[model samples]
Target: MNLSEFMNTEIVAGNTLWRITGLFGLLLVGFTAGKLLKFILSRRAEQLREPRPIIAATLGAIGRAAPFLAFALGLAAGTSLLVLNGASELVGTCVAIVVTLAISWTAICLVDAPKAWMTQRAGQTESKLDDMLAPIVSKSLIATIVVLTVVQIAQILSGKEITSILAGLGIGGLAFALAAQDTIKNLFGSMVLLADRPFEVGDRIVVDSTDGTVETVGMRSTRVRTLTGHLVTIPNGELANKSIENVTKRPHIRRIFNITITYDTPPAKVAEAKAILEEIMKDHEGMDPEFPPRVFFNEFQNSALNLFCIYWYHPALWWDYLALTERINMQILERFNEAGIDFAFPTQTVHLAGDPSRPLEVGVKGS
Candidate 1:
């Protein structure tokens, strides 16, 4: 047989040899072009990253999805020139699915570029709102893309109209919503938290029995790293309704204490105790001028004299304040001891019935 005759020979699917060869040729050309484009874009993206990060990221994402996208397009084009006999619908459906997946893959990759850019920008700023918002936005968009892709694939498989499929989905969604009411509420609660701006990441907060730093806030839950090193995940719905004390927001830490002295101390000694406290506490470390330390001999108890002391420490750093408190306590101890001042303890005096200090008379009564 001559060349033309051999080329005209029909294949099993009614596709002639020449046509099959052309189909493969187109596919090979498409793949080669796609590979070349991917290489060029990848190199360009790498070179441009430092100067134009956003554009570079976009190019990189496109390059990563180029091969699959080109292959799917090539398959569609090559199949169009073939006679599939009884498999035309099957081939077309498969091509549609491939196209949908390829597009979805590209879109999903594209989402990463913007998300990374947003995250980087957020890092540069002081506000944490964007830091928490960036990931949520990316996930939401990716989810939307996946949902649409699934709907398209379903329509292709079931040969249904988009409107009818959506209607059915709406009914099913209502049932799903009813079953997952808590999840929906948590999502809305997340929205409320974002709007309220109550606390940011790394803020120390007290909610009911949980005292911790906010690690992350998500659509369903907020993660807290507790003081005891345990991670607690609280649903946003419940957190929204609960009372939260943001300890990080306080301007100062106030301390109230009592200095007790023995009642046997003379009036001069009592006055001297108050003066010593005033001298020790004056211009204390971390002290706020507006909320100065106070020393007052406020009360006389049954066995002791009570000196009420109060002070406010600024900047509110727990460890620093504790250090200052320790130093002040040591100073008080040293000063009081040097002045021959004694700290009071609980004590009692009793007199016996036949003691020299006290004599008691008892009358016996006959019943």
Candidate 2:
């Protein structure tokens, strides 16, 4: 309102209030342009058949900072409207730094976006190994980038070597490294499992006296659904070292048993029994024909003639094989009965030719 105050304050053609209002107008334009840019970029991203997150992310980052860069430019232009002689140069430098930093942040986003997207996608796979690896890779990438960023920031601020920054963190870093020892070892173990592929998810395996189908393989441990209906978690560190037997991986299962007949069974009848058994093995759908089943008179036991039989079941599933076995056994019994072949029982004959009257002075051990 006073003459001296008004005269000194008016650096541009307009009063201070008018200049301030123009500054705001320019900022408003910057804000509107940034929003328009963001919308167009995001809409175009949505049109892509498969979104490559890196592309979308880089554009998104630039769109977000466009307004800030415009605002800084406007502010730089407005610097002459003030009374400070040094303000223009300082504002220009600041604006340049801000633009550079914004672009740098966008680059970082470009690198980081794909990893995050990949981690998310890996979780959708049927294999449990992928699920375990995704998070570990994601977190490791994040941690490494963060540490490097901090060290760079330090080097920029203090003009020190990267080595100096590392030195300062030594004690704390040592403690953290010590604590993560087991975790690191387990991660390596999981990596070994992935590479070796001893067993996969849903495989029935026996390891360390535990029998089950593998439920999940994780970075730290593997979960198994045991035959007894319990879940057992074994650390990957131990699992990698154990001998794992993948039972389901075998081609076929073997069955060996004996069929008994009375000692008095005629040799001709015995030969017929063996022939019938071989036929049964051949007639079954699941029996492995290449390995031809065998039935032979092995030996005469305490009270019976023993027939040794060997056979195989293909497509080796436990329940399926067992049911097939039951059917084969019943069929054998039926066929033998029809042929008048007698199964064995314990029998003994006693000699009493000269002991009929002397039997009063003698006794049978098991009479």
Candidate 3:
């Protein structure tokens, strides 16, 4: 018998029987196609070792999708056959199933594409931002797709109008608004942080009292990997309002040191001391020449003369700054000892009514 004759005979008996047979045949074809596609993709992935996760994931996704696409097309073809044979109800059901499968497949593929792209790109750079954001983006895409798929399924199952559902949602929207107030605030805060570019991942920053390298910026919170080796999660809203000190961006660091010498040191010696300090700073390789060092005899007290040394260092790394300061301080001590300048210590002077050798006289009789 001819292909057409067989299909006609099957449909003439009962649309349900014909549908069952056609569905099985389509499933078989889909299974075969899926297996073949999986084999081909697996071989290709094995050949390309780089971007292993992305390549393997993408290939797996494509392999899985092949079967669904084949099944959808098969169902559509079967539905068309049923319609030609005047089986309206069966054809309608098949059409709905096919449509649902098509929508779901499309959504899955759309979500997967972005994840694959991000995964592939993440291999190229050392950016902490890219590493932090990749998984977030992937999960968000998946969530959005799932939500859309559910909405589509609801529309198909309930046959409820979209406008009616939207109207219902609008009526109850106030509750949702109230529930998500903080969430919305954080969302906007995150956007602001991104646009303002205050600091980025791997940047060393001080937010209020918390000092750390920014690990990630997320939907609600910004994570910092503190120097103390702890992960701190700070709300984006609070972070936006707080004072942020971006230490990494500064080209130079200002360092100030105070030296106190005995008040007995003469003014000429102080002048000599200032000259020595200037020479020391000038000769130092770490000091920035653009902003020269200043040595000021700031103040004089009963016990000590306070001298201030202010200098700047290029490339403001903490370790480098500390090392440079230590060197300068050591040189200052050596220079002071060599020049016969003594650092001051607190001292006290007392006035006595009588000498210890001469006892106090009793004045009661005269009084």
TM per prediction: 0.85, 0.58, 0.71
Counting clashing residue pairs in each candidate, in order, gives: 0, 0, 0
The C-alpha lDDT values of all candidates are 0.90, 0.74, 0.75
Better of 1 and 2 by TM-score: 1
Arrange candidates by TM-score, descending: 1, 3, 2
Model 1 misplacement above 4 A: 1-11, 16-53, 301-303, 351-367
Q: Kindly list the per-residue Cα lDDT of model 2 for residues 70-132, writing each as its tens digit.
A: 666566566545544555555555555554454445444455465556655665676555555
Please rank every candidate by lDDT, starting with the best: 1, 3, 2
Evaluated with lDDT, which candidate comes out highest?
1
Candidate 1 lDDT, 57-132, residue by residue in tens: 8998898888888888888899998998789999999999999999999999899788879977997899988877
Worst 10 residues of 2 by lDDT: 103-112
Q: Model 2 off-target regions past 4 Å?
A: 1-162, 168-180, 344-367
Off by over 4 Å in 3: 1-143, 349-367
Which candidate model has the greater TM-score, 1 or 3? 1
Clash pairs for candidate 2: none
